[model samples]
Target: MVFMNYSTSTWILILGPLAVFLVITVWVIELLAKAPPWYPAIPIVIGFAVVFLALGVLIRAKLGKIVF
Candidate 1:
């Protein structure tokens, strides 16, 4: 099995969910306020997905294997 370095995993684990929560919270507020329908969330979600995926890839690359 592989493991991520403590710092990398810690930051990713902390920041990833924090960021997602903030973004979604704001998005929901805007949604409830009936903001423009054209303000799609797909891009925001996709952006976060890419960011987290890249963080995962970075961890894997640094550890030289998949992390559990």
Candidate 2:
């Protein structure tokens, strides 16, 4: 058996894009389809926040090593 150890930055690099893609996709779909008026706006805001945060992390990771 082989075990792989990944750092925090590495994990973020791996999952960040996937998360952003999924969030954006869902948001788009929601936009195209009709949603209930009761639907909250928090998810959309959170999605954008995640994308920005992920981009920031990726930029920092590429420019220099991440401490944690």
Question: Using Cα atoms with residue i matched to residue i, what is each candidate's TM-score against the true structure?
Answer: 0.39, 0.45
> Candidate 1, which ten residues in sequence have the lowest lDDT sum?
59-68
Over the stretch 1-68, how does candidate 1's per-residue lDDT look in tens digits?
A: 23344578665764576577667766765674575664676567557766866785566557543342
Q: Which 10 residues in a row give candidate 2 its minimum summed lDDT?
A: 1-10
Clash totals, every prediction: 0, 0
- Per residue, candidate 2 scores C-alpha lDDT tens digits across 1-68 of 11146667777766677678767767765764566663576577567767877786677556534443
lDDT of each: 0.61, 0.64
Predicted structure with the largest lDDT when compared to the true one: 2
What does the lDDT come to for candidate 1?
0.61
> What's the distance in Å from true for residue 59, model 1?
24
Q: Model 2 lDDT vs. the true structure? A: 0.64
53 Cα displacement, candidate 2 (Å): 20
- Model 1, total clashes: 0
